[model samples]
Target chain A: MRSDVLVGAVSILFGMAYTVQTLHLPKAMVGNPWAPLFFPLALGVLLVAMGIVVLLKGLRHHPSSAKKGGSKRLIVVTILICLAYTALFERIGFIPSTILFLGGLLFAVNGAKAWIVNSLIAVTFSFGVWYVFEKIFYMNLP
Target chain B: MELIQNLLLGFSVVLTPLNLIWMVAGSILGTILGMLPGLGPTTGIALLLPLTFTMEPATALITMCAVYYGAMFGGSRSSILLNVPGDGAAVAACFDGYPMAQNGRAEAALAISAIASFIGGLIATVAFVIVAIPVARFALRFGPPEYFMLMIFALSATAAISKEALFKGFISLLVGLMISTVGIDYQTGVLRFTFGLMELQTGIDFVVVIIGVYGLGEVFKNLENIASGGGLQAIQKKFGRIWITLDDWRRSIIPILRETPVGFLVGVLPGAGATIAALMAYNNEKQLSKEPERFGTGTIEGLAAPEAANNACSVGALIPMMTLGVPGSGTTAVMLGALMILGLQPGPLLFQQHADVAWAVIASMFLGNVACAFINIPLAGLLVRVLAVPPKVLYPVIVALAFVGVYTINFSVVEFVLLILFGLVGYGMKKYKVPTAPLILAVVVGSSMEQNFRMALMLADGDFGVFFRNGICWTLFFLAIGSIAWPFLSSRIKLPWNRS
Candidate 1:
């Protein structure tokens, strides 16, 4: 359950998966046989070897304490909010989605202090930025 | 004589009204952004890249370089006033700067920092100009094999020098290079890692990764800190005086002079940047000081050396990028990306082909340093007020800006999603104490490395020994091996000396 071990295991899995994918690439007709696959395959093997070393070191060392409960929950909530905002970005429109996203983030961080002020800021920022980008810069904002 | 003429041409280009205004504007904006917690020059340049899309290449490049200079100056302000480093490079500044603020000499600290920054930047710019011309000429002889070896040296040096565990650094680099391998393989006309996704066919955009990793990732970390009640502290408003006395000047001058070249040389090396330069300069100053113990207690020399080193380093990083087409830091890599976006290639040919753009950029750096120092010194009091805006309010706006910046670049939904994904990954990397610089640098140079690697092999008819056949390539290969081995060797060698 050590962090290094987890990292090493993930790396090994990724390296193996990448090696398999590289093997499946169609061969080239000309140039070196090692052209496309050479660099990646070598990297994969190096990765696996390093992962094993890290895994061994991790097993030998003491595990560090895990992240705090509240921090973890907050990070999870933030990620979910960001995912929702991204999913609804075009559908809800830039202004509405951005306002909601900003307002939600503000509330999440500060717990609803000065609700009117937060709302004003959220609206102004979303609209102001949208205007600058769309109207001034001529970037199309969905 | 040629240098003088080129500089005159540069000055003429930069002296235009619009370009001058852009330079000043970039300085102001970059200073403010760099003063913000967790946002450095890289983020400042990345966030503002979309605005320059419509401008001329020379104008766009000048603006970005000005921002780069402004950010370096601004970084010292936060380190001096609040003891919070505005960026990684400013960490050394905090050692002596915070103590100065604590000792009620905040104004003196700020003044000396600005002055030292100006001197360092000026000297480094001069050095960059001197080094770049010959380096570019020398680089003209570089074939594919030499380029490949240079990139390998860069990668290895980056991995070895990063503060993280060496293996972890290499792993982070491998991750980046692997990401670069995604999309259609150009030579074979085959999709490598597309996995049937239309978006994957083009691979991931570097800007998207940058925005996600540095911008949004920083936000996520700040959010957790805020939730944990570990947010920004209220900054002290009373700055006594904006001037350093003659005695203060006397103490700072020598350290500033001594650290400039040290910082510049460090900056010239690819992958080792301002952070290392500042740390080394600070340490060297401490060693040479009569009062070594006074270093962490806010001595003027302690404050000056690192500030000078880091600011000088900002200019030092440009030399390799301009002359050899290799970025020396994350910020330089972003600037390199900016150059490519503006339809200009950096490298030896840049000076010959786009002399106007190159010279203007160089001239703008000179102008930017003067502008930033003047602006920073007079406005230090007002700028520190930016720290008053709590994380709760500021981070949300930053997140919105990041999204807007990324969206404006290509407006691809998949890229935006990739931004979020990398942001989380970047957060995880930070949590695990893995350095992100090498990873970012790898992504920037990975494609070029691959191209040069293949080209070298093709030219030599698949002979593996072609990489070491030439002296330049052989030297670079050894340098790469040496850099990677140096850390381990140093640790082992120290044992015997310690015993003795």
Candidate 2:
């Protein structure tokens, strides 16, 4: 699918969902017609209108460039690494998690060359920053 | 005399030993961060913000402002040497700056930018001091209706000036406004769009969003390039004298003087900042030059105008932020968030209520600009070497630091997850050519807009006509309409001079 079409479709879905949610919000008290839903409903309508325009424009025009092949894999893999790091952050503790995350990312991007240097850099940065934030700034890290 | 007294009080506050030390330290740190690829003032300020959580408001604000000024000065170094802009505002500098470096005038280019930035910052600070008091006083008369219209005008102006498609800008803005509504609605005691999550009650934190969008999102964008071993590399150059001669100074003085006010005026308009100012100033210089063809080559006017304009614009951006409580750019929006975090409300009452903090910040700008220029000129060679750090190594460290920075705020895993999610969203937005500035700005202003709207409606017993009754309100409404229509109208309206 074209990028604009995808954007428009997502936006329409979001607008509809939010509109439904807004309708469920409690109404304003007596003598007050201005409810919690007023502003969001207005925005929802604007979003739907803008979505239609974007969708039509997308359908009318073709994309100038096709998607490239390799970068998608790199981006996905990196996001997964970050997610894994975040998930294990508190469980494994800050220093170990940071070292693993940094080393993993470095190895993933640069490939497993010079294991000593990569390990050293990962260890040094994680511990060095931890020391500064913990000792100097007095910020508690998990 | 009153201005002089306040300035004296401000100087006393900033001249304290601790504040002065932080200013110098911030300048050095900001220069290093600015020279690094993918980290500008916004990211620099965001990353350093957590450290200031325990300091006095004056100290915290001055340090952050110093960082901002230093980043603006340091941005030109990478632009000149490697033809890679360290920040969006430095993009214009690359045109003439890189060519000058290629022609073996790297030192001269560096020196001129440093001097121009210094002069620009000094003049803009003076302008800021002169304008801030009156702007604040004028804003004291704004009721909720006028305030609402002003925000609308801000949103419309942002949409109009966005480099993306017009509708896309509006879409981004609306999305931000919607996201802002996710927490509990302050009025009527209703839970909004929370979907039963306990954490959603407090709304999304803007600082988390900023770190995610700028820090992690940029990391994701550069991941492929780093994988391919194609990230930024330092340009090798020898620094000789690092000073411009008399001829260079003679040519630069006029352009600097001309571009500073242009930059300042443009920057005072909400959502317009250094990037636009620099681009406009560069174009204006080209038009005024006798040899316009030499602009993209190695021209002193080309280098001086943009360098000065961007620095002036950085200071000019503070005018609205400090006085009217509206951020003129994404960086200023972050600064506003910082101010709020420090328990300071940056509106008209700020000058009256927090006069000490406000004046100290203004005075610090004067000291920060001079300090940054002095440091940058002597340390240009050292700062440029920061670019040599491999992105593969540097980015991961940045990611780690980002996680730690966000975590230090609340120590919540959920917020960390939100950071990663917004990072992905930011990456997607960048891929789709959606402007992030409008979205961030909207997020900053959405709640305030809602508060003003509700208050105005309450004051008028829910009459919509209340929005148009006042002169200021009507003026702002028309300005909003004009701004939204200007982009489409400019292309269609053929001038008489072009009727041939």
Candidate 3:
């Protein structure tokens, strides 16, 4: 469906914002007429052009379906899980949150017997990774 | 004599107990990961990169190379026994490998893949050793202007590789470049695309982007079709007696020999990685085969050619990473990231200053590939059993792993959001048939290309013609032109503007 339209439109708006921002850089300090800003500015222009193409393509692919899909409910739920995991990682810790988040995700996907298996696997994998990073590699993990 | 001395020093470092342990660990992990569906070397390396923070650069690099080469050797396991390709490079392997498995020749397929991989790796290693020193010296001659031209070439080639319409590829490349410019500008110190958000000042982490694109995107894509039924028969391929018959060896040997150099050289080129080399090798082999019709149905040559190409390409990828500091493949990109994290800037100067380290990495790759061949061939059956794991169970785990990996990078909530957003973008790009490789290549090569372009301009005193003035630069430019023109030239898409 034209689900990519809004995303492409937002991208074009961001590109415009970037182009306006690039204008403020001092060209004199940039030296040569091409300057450091040239490539970025050029990219911004191309981004807007590409965004427009994407928008048009998306619209043509689905004039009405972009806004009408209950399946997209899953997207919101997924996003929330991500946010919850992010907000909770340092507090609840990476291993706990990762296993819990994975359990929830698998459950949502109708995983049946796979949910418990996934939970165990997630706990093991996350802790295994954490142990390697923090204990062995001495990385300061969240 | 100098080479021998440096190599001996490298061997000393690589053979250290700690590094050897890391190499074995990396290879085992890599083989398992490659045996799984959807995950590739990129995910394996990226997920491991954050852990490399404490290891010495030489150890980190050798470990990463081990994983990369091990994955190449092991990816065929899934393709040969389960019909599921482990990665893009292995996609061609499925054309022949799976049928061989179904025909009860899985052992033969696995055996030929190991031999081909070993041969390809060996040839590419020799080429790497021969080419690296001279190439690093030659690349040292590049001034900012030359660097700029090279970057532009990388960017242009990346943008053009997309299977989508040129305009869409341009958009994806532009988005990457724009994302790259979001942080404080190198010259002006002007913040870009930050929109007053505090987190934006640091720019989006490359880890976040990669995890989103490769890891999370994979999860979402898998979710879209999880209900689709597929069987996971215990890889019943007879295990212990793996060996290609004389007929099998005869068919594969010639193709492996032909594909190694082709794959290696293509892989050595900046931005052309194992995936391309594998695809090109398969296509070239098919074109040359008297029984081209047997390609997709299951041919040993198809299995051998792409397997050889992937391993050759692994070695080929090291050429630019070691010589020019430009990574030709995603695994090498992570290796570059590891090097950068170690505060070791790799370039022409790197070879002169750290010959021992550079040569050690090269020497370790040689040993690692040999190690992978020995280790992987015996474990192919066990690894192929990875397909028995239901996708339903695996997808969520992959997503969780990706989330945790990115979150650990900085404990930033914003980066997590960025991961989901980029995953959606990646999913969208996939749906539209837009190639993600170009966008990634652009992102990886983005900084160098931009820096070089501006340097070139400054060196020429702002003369645009300077890009064309040098014969080498002009040749590169024309090659870019040729790359652009290639599709239309080969296809029947006649364009008036394409007239020579």
Candidate 4:
């Protein structure tokens, strides 16, 4: 029930913010000035309306706490690892950063016990793809 | 004659040694990927989009379509063997397929599934050749107002997936449209909501968003599932005899035929996809059965009906996206994006401008189906080896590939941030029970919908009444309203044959 309300409330807030942004969009000297803003504005308004319905539906449903599954810590750890990988992606270059990214994720997900297998997969994937894209396809990779 | 000529043209292109090699490779890879739990054809194509980045449109599409058919068959393989459906469309197979396997007739079950899918696919492909040209030509009459309203109808019908949470679908589509509204307004030079980022100029690529949402999002969701002790227990798969009995074919022939047309029609309708077609076909078979009680206790007819419908439904779903520019399901929506990425526009123009490409896709469907059947039938034992791969190890590879694909497209890390952002968003959307397919359709069609809408208004000189100026628009409006209302009314209305 709370998830619904939270989603609804955030939607309404975003919609309002979007509408405000739509209002400030520069008037086009070419065609009708209002034409460009029309679609976004309409979308913004519809979102608010839908959000209200969602909020009402949430309120109407018998409130039982939805027992959420999955570990937040694991998800967060994956995100942080990705962030670190992204930060180091250009600085450390493609192959090294990718190996680290894939390695960190594999280890985080699989475990320390399977480090050999995990490292092998990580190394093979990163180097194999990099070589293929850069050398064979002749496509540039950051 | 034209159909034959078109098929010959497509064959000439696809029969090349190079294209055949790609087709075989793609089919095999797609089967492996599809056997992986939680990765459907949508994810398969999205993950593989990078490899197609440099190929010719026909070659790229051939590879993708092979992947599509391979994944379709692979989805049901796991359903029969492990009772774990690899894709949503395979859920119906779980009803009787697992029970048949448990009864030690796993070989019969697998064989019949392939046979049914092949018959359904071939028939549906013939139907596609017959009808696709007419549908494309019909869509040529759609003016701006008609096209815009048609998009509205398509998106709305897609969102009406649930009776209880219609708003969730609305919110999902609105989120997609909102994302589409970013970057500079193509009509006016004004920036809508870039937030002063240079990379935001081109707006977000739907492929990146899709890879993030589907590819990464699925992995993230799987990660969550693994952590929660909800992952499927790995089973050592073994196949018995690889051929179905003559008696098995006799019982299934009727159900397969009955469901093919039903599946085809449902599949062509926007928002009703292969999953629903399979489910409906299963129910219809049960209703028509003389021994309905045998359904849950491992009946050959039960497995055959849904398998036939599942393949038919996928073939039927492609017609709209390839001809009318309205993607009927999420998988088609993803493939629609791929078609556009190939620098060809779908709809009436597709047939006129890139007729060879459009026909080639249909022609490839025939070969793709044959390829899938060949691999699935003889190579079933070899392919099921991929089932031993653990989800924990497999998901990281998907994430790495998705990000690499994203990098190849734009060469920007800003897209990576958006990928991660939408990945989380997609995960959240799934958790909340919001359908993400409508969101993909909305994103794919958002720009065109807006453009047509604005064009209609400009043509009408700001009069809103122009929407009512055409019969097609009126029909679209009526259907859109009906589509939304049907979900709510369906539960209340009692059908004569609704046993449930």
Candidate 5:
């Protein structure tokens, strides 16, 4: 349910952003009634409307199985880990950065024991995938 | 003798050490991805598409086809055991599949799906090899106006899948059309929505969007449940050998026969992808069954029908793509891109121009399906174990793999960012139950549809009714309308045959 809210907020935000961005475009001159902004503006309205409808619907239903909290923190951490991995991937290489990222996510979401076990398994699998993509398939993964 | 010789050549293609290894690897990878939540065959194929660039077209097509069949095979594995379908088509499989699992019949369920899919694929491949030539010739009769109407037919017929409001389906389609406009205009060379980024000039890579939406969004949604107390305990089940009994075969034979053609026909129609084929077949089987209420409770027919239908649909999709230059699904669209990359324009002249390549590809589907069956069948339990890998272990690996895969295409961070954004949006839309298939389909076919419409009009001096003026175009246009109308009409009047 909270996921619904977060998703709704994102939709509304993006829709508004789309609307604002398209507002700068000049209107199509009197040939085809549709302008460049016409579609975007309408889409923005529809998206905002959909978001509002979804938010309201979610509020009314109140699904009890919905998990509360923990995700926000983890999402932030996951983002940081992803950004860090992207930065580190080239220098540290695919296997190492993958180990770190997988370990970080496992620890963040499922705690440290999961982190250790998953990290080991992930490291092994990453090596296999890297071998296939990089060595066999000759994919130039940094 | 000629057919046999051609098939032998196909065997040589599949038997090559590198190609065989890739096929095995693709199935393994596809099965793993399919077992996981949120990642579907499209994501699997899209993630791996760049690998195709380096290989012979035959190897590329076979590897991708193996992955496609493997994912379809694997989709049921999770849905049966975990009640989570990695792809939408498997949702129907889960209705009965999970119940069978609960009854300690996971092996039976898995075996049935494998056999059913194998039969379906075999039927389709045979049809592809034997009938595709004449069918492609027949499809060549369609001109630009006919093509325009055919796309509309494809789009409208998809509404039949919407169990709820038809309006919602149209809304979904409208969204797809909107996304299809996100790059440079095909006619004017004017930018549509790119905010001056040079990377935007190439438009959205269909694969990236597929990865982000289907792949990333699924992870995020599953994360909440995983963090909560939603992860299951004791998924390990003891079972006898993964083989369908004679009785099981008896039950499935009729369904395979019925659904083979059903899936093929559905697959032949544009936008009615494997999921829809599977769904329709499942629904049709339920309606046909004497014990209709047995549908969601682990009926073998439930497994057999959709499994057969979806795989057959793959073959069905190729007819229009090869003959009409209109792709029926995202994977087929990518195959169309493969067609373009190989410098073989698809449409009417393709058969005359590239018969060997086209015939060889059709021939390969026969061999590929057989290879997929071998890979899937005696290995069902091992594949199901792939699902036991917890999300904590899997998500990061997939994300990293996806990122690396996308980045390696051009080594551009801008592409990565676009990939991530699409992932978030795809995830969000998926969470909200907005279907992703139409978006990609629309994008792929959009330029062609608009271009054909404009051309038809220009030929008639900008008259809108030029599309309907010709007898061929008018027949197709009405057929499109009738298809969309038939489902709604059928749903309204309870047939005399509707038992309950």
Candidate 6:
């Protein structure tokens, strides 16, 4: 599918769904009952209209020869690493989970061939950031 | 007389020891962040946000402003040396800047960029000083209807006035607006599209989106580039001399002066930013030059004009954000949001309510511009060593910092989840060839836009005609319509009346 067409279709679906959700918002006990719904409802309708225009425009154009979504797997791996980091953050603490997260990303993207260097960087960045935020700023981390 | 007193007041605020330290620190950090691809002023300020939480409002703003322009300066460094722009605002620099490096005049190109930027920024700051007070005073007269109209003009112009991607801009904007609607409604205390998550009830912070898109999103995108064998290139080590010659200086001075105003004008308009200003300066220089063909071939005029205009544009863009509280671009939106968090809200009353803070921000722009040039030039050789650090390791560190930045927000792991999610969203937007500016700008302006609109409605007793009750409203309405129409009209049809 053409990119614009796919995006447009997604937008239309999103807009319609959003409109329904806006409609279900609890009625306001104060001020106009319609006030909360007004802006969002307009946004939903406009998004659907914009989607149609984009879809129509995409239909008129010839298929593009743009570069394929290069390195899809790499992106997936990074996201998974991040997800694991998020899940582990509170349980494992900032220092340990961050090192694992950074180390994991480095290994995946930078390659394990330079394992020692990547490990060092991940460890150093994790510790350095912790020291600054916790010690200097008096801001806590999970 | 009043102007001089205000200038002194501004200087006094900036001269404080704490403010000076933060300003210098911000300039240094901002340059480093700006030099990296995918990070711009937005990411730079957002990443440093937690640091500013402990600072005085003036100090925090000063530091962020330093980062804002410092990144603009550093952005051109990569454009000249590596033939890649650090951000969107630096794209025009690549047109002639890269060719200059290729010609082994990298030193000259680097020097001229700093010089032009310094002169341009100083002049633009002067203009800002002259206009800021008047503009703020005038803005005091604006009511809810006027503000709502202004919001419409800014949003529609942002969506409509791009060189291309008009519809894509709209899509990006609507998505941002939708994101803005996610939290609980303020006036009526209605729960919004919170999806049962307590975090959603408070609303998704725009700072998280910035960190995700600019920091993590760029990293995600870079993984693709690295996989495709398009990682950052090796750096050049030596330069014969780092200063521009009198000959190069003579050619550049005129274009730099001419373009600063153009850039400043465009910067004041909502939705426009340094990228547009730089491009316009480049185009204007090309048209006026005797050797227009020399443009893409590394002409000094081409390089200097864009460099000057973009820096000037950064300074000029601050006017609207500071004076009227309507940010014209993503960078300013980030600044506005960060400042609001710092408890120094920018708007018509800012100068009246917090005159010291307002003027200090203006003064800091001049200092930041100068500080960035100092960093980018004398330390150009030292800084390029950073580029030698392989992207493989650098990207991961950036991701860690992004998480840390978000974590600083509420010190919650939940914010990290939101960061990653927005990062993915940012990556998706990139893949689909959509611009991120309108999306971010919308997110920052979204809540306030809705608030002003509702307030206007409430005061007018639900009569829609209240919007058109004033001249300012009509002016904004017309400007918005014109901006939306121009893209379609400019290409498709030319009437006979145009023949005259």
Give me the candidate number with maximum DockQ: 6
TM-score of chain B of 5: 0.87
Taking the tens digit of each residue's C-alpha lDDT, what string does model 4 give over B145-165? 998888888898899976866
Model 3: per-residue Cα lDDT at residue B443: 67
Top candidate on lDDT is 4
Q: Which runs in model 3 stand beyond 4 Å of their true positions?
A: A1-14, A24-36, A51-75, A110-115, B162-165, B227-240, B290-297, B493-500
Cα deviation of A124 in candidate 5 (Å)?
Answer: 4.4
Superposed Cα deviation of residue B4, candidate 3 (Å): 2.5
Give the TM-score of each candidate.
Answer: 0.96, 0.96, 0.89, 0.98, 0.82, 0.97
lDDT of 1 by residue, B401-474 (tens): 88878887777767778888999988877776666777788888888888898888889888889898889988
TM-score (0 to 1) of chain B for each candidate? 0.96, 0.96, 0.91, 0.98, 0.87, 0.96
Q: Poorest 10 consecutive residues of model 4 chain A by lDDT?
A: A65-74
Which runs in model 4 stand beyond 4 Å of their true positions? B495-500
For candidate 6, please provide the TM-score of chain A on its own.
Answer: 0.95
Could you tell me the lDDT of residue B333 within candidate 3? Answer: 65
Pick by TM-score: which candidate is best? 4
Q: Tens digit of lDDT per residue, candidate 3, span B293-377?
A: 8987778898899889888988887887778876655567667766876878787888899877787788888788778877767
Candidate 6's DockQ: 0.85
TM-score of chain B of 4: 0.98
Which lDDT tens digits does candidate 5 get at residues B1-500?
Answer: 76667666556656668777777787777777676766778777877776776777667766777777778777877788788886877877877888888877777888888788878888887877776667667777776777888787766665334433243344455555556656765545557677777887766665566666656666666666666667754565455787778888898889988998988888887666787788878888888899988888888888888888977887788778777787767677666665555456777677667655565566556666666676666776666676677676677666766776677666776766766677666656655566666566666666567667766765776677877777877777787777667656766887532322
- From the highest DockQ down, the ranking of the candidates is 6, 4, 2, 1, 3, 5
lDDT (C-alpha) at residue B258 in model 1 = 100
Give per-model CA RMSD: 2.5, 2.5, 4.1, 1.4, 4.7, 2.6
How accurate locally is residue B53 in candidate 6, as Cα lDDT from 0 to 100? 77
Q: Runs in model 2 with CA error above 4 Å?
A: A27-34, A67-70, B492-500
lDDT of 6 at B406: 83
Could you tell me the lDDT of residue A19 within candidate 3? 86
